[model samples]
Target: MNSHQPDLRAAVRRLGRRHFLTLTAAAAALAFATDLPAARAASVPELDARKIAENPFTLGVASGDPLPESVLLWTRLAPRPLEPDSGLPDKRVVVTWELAHDETFLRIVRGGTATAHPEFDHTLHVEVTGLDPGRPYYYRFRTGTWESPTGRTRTAPAPGTATSRLKLAAVACQAYHHGYFTPYKHLAGEDLDVVFHLGDYLYEYAVDSAGGSRAYTDRVLPAHFNREAMTLADYRLRYALYKSDPDLIAAHAAHPFAVTWDDHETENNYAGDTPENSVPPEEFLLRRAGAYRAYWENQPLRAPQQPKGPDMRLYRRLQFGQLAQFDILDTRQYRSEQAHGDGWQKARPEAEAPSRTITGETQERWLLDGWKDSSATWNVVPQQVTFAQRRDKPTADFKLSMDAWDGYPASRQRILDGAEAAGIKNLMVLDGDAHVGYGFDLKKDFQDPASRTIGTEISTTSVASGRDGADKPANWDDLTQANPHLKYYNGRRGYTVITLGTDRARVDFKTVSGVTKPGGTLTTAASFVTEAGRPGLTPA
Candidate 1:
């Protein structure tokens, strides 16, 4: 490390915190911004197909961000996925894609050509339009003689169509070193209209050369992946490693996913404009820029979701006719730092500060306004972290997860109060993280068991982060006893299935027996039904 670096950071910190961060963030990405067009300008570097040694579609293909009439298709040309440059030359390659009505490509409907520039890591995104609403479409990409794996995607129901039903699966937290992606394989086979990946798509931590917990004896991974991701190339390579999993690829191919990121996508428990460790904000912003850009290139996001410097607008709404309206949130990007210095802590005055916000002012306003005008029968919210309050033990001096909504009392209160004011009768909240499944009746006052059940929150277990977990965790009894609002709890590796019909909503807590080994058994641990105009969980 440079001896003078500390002095430089100290000088930078003298300026106003908010304004200085904005300036430094822009400064950090200026060079990256200026370099993109330079590489894009030298775009004509085509070579004969015979000269290429192997197929470049090793990463497979995916489609996401579905609309009533359109959906985005994504694929990267990665003959060698873990390479720094994805093993592709610094040239633009013309990739053609076809959307067909059948899996065999027997009936081609939409076709187009897009240039996959190395400036954007040779990823291709084709937004297909002019399609019938509430239908399935098969798509694939081709360049020269090589073709990608066929992917199936479905569009949302038409607006005001009075849809009778909607099916969705929520998943997240797939750390490669923890276990195998067995849950995704099971999820791929389930009949769902759409999938929502609630973040932590990939961890920033290092993986062993033997492929971490999987302990791969068949092959050894590269040494570059044995360290934390810190640079743009590092983050990109990390994504390639996670995406190369066959089960994850299969899940993407099976259904279009709407995704949002959590802390692990950049760093663990990092708050808005604040690094988890004691790292300088300027340095963290530079790292965040790389993480954000790599996220955009890899995911099947549209142009509107693209990143600028260290910022990206990932929060948006997706409606499924009149059955459900999903307000996808980005809580990690705008939350205040973890109060009381991380981990579980008792309530503190700083945590209750009205000025300390989880969703920044603008996003809070957006969410409130969206709720006020919502028309769907079930107003669903897919966000990071737990919503209901969770205490450590059955006592008045109980501690709570400082990283979750429990630390942001004021923010949670505003949201809960807003729901009641808007006359939101059937409110549903889907949360990720915790590495365990929890069904909570969101209440206005946790101290009172009879408090109004303002909403319902179904928190899904991790995909593979916690390895093979048991049904009853060590603190299961304590957690269930202390928090009366918490109706269910299970420590397992799996996702959750949420189905909305015309009159009611049902949530199934799906659990996998194991993820350390292949072919884990998937079973519904529990199921709950909440009737329309009644915000509570009833055993189904």
Candidate 2:
């Protein structure tokens, strides 16, 4: 925890007292909803006898979606995770939780009870509030005599105050079958407020069928993961398998997370109502709904983000005092189908049509409105897909990925224009999903370098997607030289760390030497800084 203890009374004033009261009421209601597990034991003797003998916290504990006055704590009850139904009797279980000022529970502040219903994969999310802002809190959950791991989470600073700095790590695309989560173990030790998982939290396809750059080298996945995740039970089992990773659990316990999904969470390169495979629209929707429900059950998101059928509103804003504000966007949900069905496509007339949208009209309006109204010093857009334009060939003809922002030129232009019109000078865009690191300046017109530099974009690589990736991939030099705005590129596995100061924002491209094996070393491959007013990347 940062030791600079600001005045709690002043912090309360910044976080309005009325809002504090409302949060207290919400927490109380969550506590009142569940009856004690011991109280129900006598009535359900059979279920009690089959009580979890082994540790149900194998998947570990996580905390996320922090606010000035509230935060969410999450844990799933899984005694035998590899089993079909998590090896538990089909019954609702009462779970107890506590938030404290210190790691030890001696100085407890708030405690509550929640029901982990089997309908929701026995996952629990407790929304807690009325704590002092910009400070660390320790939280843990308990079911009967079994207890979860203690997780450390920090709340956001009071909304409108001028905090000095904010630290965050951007991570994505961890394919469990490819390699080990060694990078996440390194991330767990960093001093960070949050980990923005840009997407691909867990891949949905089979280990062998999901053709990546390389084969599985770290370890063999459980037998259940050999198949694709199609049903609700399959999705739940996949999440359990990923959560069982120790390094990933460590990262979750170390800090709160704000996450959004990419295509692989459900199916490869899926658009709004269209799946990558040629499944019928009706059947694909059912699969999508199942994936969405499983994602919600595992993450630490609040009730508002819960899915209603196939529709779930995930784009939202998180503020860190007056220093920084993050607008987390969901690009996979309401996007138009990939041009030419997911490959390099010529920039044609239809591709540039105004009707073609990557972010649906509603989300586009919401993002533009957020830019227009945001008052923070540094505004960040944490989203999936590469925001910059990358040309694959060196010829006069432009070739780019139809699945990325390049495919929707008109929509991208609108966002850049909105930022410029709203006078958002310190705009920063962070993304993941390429399985490669990209450091570049966001040009108003990607094709023309003479155009204005509107912002800086730092796209982090995968945690472990391309196993032991080559340092110099095919056409790497040609592509970097062709696109002069691209400051740095790395094919190795890693995540990017961003440190936001009042005057400047520094981005460190942290890479692990290897991920195919355990205990790889961490190294800073490159570092770039963007000054407060200037929106271009400079080698730091």
Candidate 3:
């Protein structure tokens, strides 16, 4: 076992003290109700395991990627409720899945059988193909005598088809300990074509550990995560616990998901070889290897994402027929550490810097060359973190966070320069991370007032996790004012919805009252639009 495990345990113990105090306050509030007949009664409500078995798939079934011919289906078999801690069972069960053109069983199209092994924590990913495009389908899974609830899914129209429009939702940053995922539950109710998960899907922290920035609130998670996850079983159990959330599963079942991971999937502020928590170089690699393996096994990704040790090349292009092409980029795992300097200084070694890289040499060339050659009307770069260069003035003493693309100035400039050189039109950047929403005009130089805008970016805030504690609103507001490029900023939790049409694209920023609460109302706080050939964002 790693020596650092002791340090992590100590941190959790310290955090427990604070949690106990909060619980005491809650107990005091409930103490008044003790006089009621129900409270005075000696018997308490009891839960029976046999009753829960009647609904084996309580977490629900989900499908993603409704393509003209295929869609990915997912489900987990939780056979033993009493053994929730391990989320593993020794017995292997045969899982049967079927897809139909209609909600009823009359038009069955595809069917298959697979085994849910204990090694994968009883979770299964079934990619069903050979279905008609642009048509809705319903699917379900069966294990022994238990049947999962049916889920609906649809595929994208074939390339260059006569489809009029497409609706997609963008979201990210869901830390289970931070808040409830009520926003996802709301998004699942909408009629969407696909969901774009930009990143920060799971946080790698022990449950009792005080969220680095805030105290625990009303959100629920496992009672204890005593150590940093390094083994495959540890990672598997973490994903299982997260996937069990009904809201997340509902959203996944409602529409297809296009996903990418940000720092928290491994560690906060992780650069190429170094993580923010500063695990030794050798140990970091091993942890990364296990983390990547778990990520691939849990996600509904294509075969290309199969993990090989610590590396899983996730940057790839997904075409949505003739309407658009998504070039998902990986900004982590291949960048230099933060530059050392005084104040908000610009990175030195501008043109000849051989050490700085964001997309790496190969991926950068691939992205630029792909942009130059693509024929789609919209060039969408669905990536993690912000791309717009954010800088604090010389006297402000603010520098770029080493974890984001801003740390690699040379490479960022090159990508922008490539777009200019390629004359790529209608370039839209979908960004996450930074826990705040922003719509910026991506300019070659932010310092220069006369700098021309190159493209447009729509940054989504955190789905659940963000700035916690007393300074929340103040910090968010100050960041927004400092960065004039930001169009909207909210300390509250929520997600974004985008609709792409032939001539225009509309983006709606939806915020929930609070994720710390079980359920919250959602409202569109702001909206923006981008015309097909204009390439810049405008108020909707």
Candidate 4:
């Protein structure tokens, strides 16, 4: 065989791949149009808009899990949102969805009908399929002449295909009583591909009728929201209240979001069935079931992600062509109870026990195995807490957050060792729940300044949890002087925008001046970038 002939064959194979991806959407569209009938096969009860007291699409629309050929679209029907039953009679409703290449939807590629059962709180999950690789599409839902706001979503690049750039926003920690969610308004306007909500989607706290620090002078919240979420109905109502925010609704409508939960989703600092308070294991599991059930109903997740009792397999992988692979983990569900009562404590022997695991043993194995043959340029982990060691004092007697990865040093060691064994490159861990933006160089040994750099971790600040924070806390100098691996830090309320490319990944800490009232000006508090091959963070 001629050597030049082999080169020509390689070029032809590349061209063939491009051809397939280009035709995937158009071909699927034609096949769907010819295969299925447009009308619903079975008859259902009709829901007239005039009969219903209010607009059903009050929570707005959202899409998630952007696969190459399909995406999960979500919306709930709630006319009177705060009511336990959402003011709807116990009945099923049919929702029609349309997806098009243009905003006007003149050239719709896919259209379908989905039933919203009262069993699932009238929530709709339309897994629209047959789409081109990395292509943008506009979609909306319709029921009884009521139309939901149009949402824009894009699919990932075709499998094994090389992509140029991917933009993402990491967000978390919203406390309604603390302040308003101003960050989301700015986030909705940004040009981004996806959003990663690491955790703390809603705080299990009480909100007064006036809406906490928001102090809504125009309206009053329902009395039901005045207590922490405990029952399934309470949890569902909490989601409705959070989703009612226009800024948050707009953010979800703008981009697809991939989510994973932390402690606050169920209970503060909860580890599996173990509750933070002195609650019975069996009783606490019941609360967990409620939280998980409500979480699945509200989010744009598929059937497989739904909870079975208190167990939910939320640890899964999402890929963006050959550019990045995100391993979304559930650290709060399958973790060892935090040592030293789950607070900042001196290094303890119990945390170093080999049996101690934060990702659980099964999930740890899965995460390590996924990295073995990863074709993506960046192996990312969108998880709950900080992956790097955050010590209060520089000395050996320093204290670490037991609620974070520092309390699971043995588990952290296993993950780091596994990455090294798998020959993984460009390891990036995205974190939420810190209430402050942080950039750190993940090291094999935090005690040693010359230790090998394992990866880079960026912990994004809260949307409204910490209230209006200062640029530097009182212990800023002490913290900077202590942890040498800590490259950047910002005490504010905002999110992090990550721009990933083949060569490097850059994270811009986007902060707002304040969140107490509303309309805080967004600004970049700091910027950091890590090279593709190298694992340490550097100021960009």
Q: lDDT for model 2, on a 0 to 1 scale?
A: 0.83
Model 2: per-residue Cα lDDT over 228-311, one tens digit each:
898777888889878888999999999999989998889989999798888766456657766887899899899899875556
The per-residue C-alpha lDDT of model 3 at residue 400 equals 57
Candidate of highest lDDT? 1
lDDT of 1 by residue, 1-540 (tens): 100011223333554346547745454443434366354466557655445477898888899988999999999888888777677776677888999999999999999998787767888878899999999999998888898899999999998989998999999899999888999999999999999998899999999888878874465889999999977778888999999999999999999999999999999999998988898787787678778888998999998987776788999988888888889999988888889998999898988899888888899899889998888899999999998999999988899988999999899999989988998888888888899999999897877999888889989999999899889999998999998888889999999999899888889999988988777888999999988888888899
In candidate 1, stretches whose alpha carbon ends up further than 4 angstroms from where it belongs are 1-20, 23-28, 31-34, 37-39, 42-44, 47-50
Error of 4 at 329 (Å): 0.6
- The stretch of ten residues in a row with the least summed lDDT in candidate 4 is 1-10
Backbone clash pairs for candidate 3 read: 65-256, 66-154, 66-155, 66-156, 67-155, 68-133
Ranking by TM-score: 1, 4, 2, 3
Quantify all predictions' global Cα lDDT against the true fold: 0.86, 0.83, 0.69, 0.84
Model 4: per-residue Cα lDDT over 1-540, one tens digit each:
000001222332444434423334323322232221123324334455456667899999999989999999999999888778887875667888999999999999999998776667889888888788898999999888689999999899888888889999999999887888999999999999999998989988999988888874476988989999986777888999999989999999999999999888888999976899997565566577668878998999987997755667898889989999999998988899999888999987988898999999899999999999788899999999988888886666778899899999999999999998998878999998889888999887888989988899999999999898878876677778889999988888999999999999999999999998887899999888899999999889
Among all candidates shown, the one with the greatest TM-score: 1
Model 1 clashing residue pairs (backbone): none
TM-score of each: 0.95, 0.90, 0.82, 0.91
User: How much is 497 displaced in model 4, in angstroms?
Assistant: 0.7
* lDDT winner between candidates 3 and 4: 4
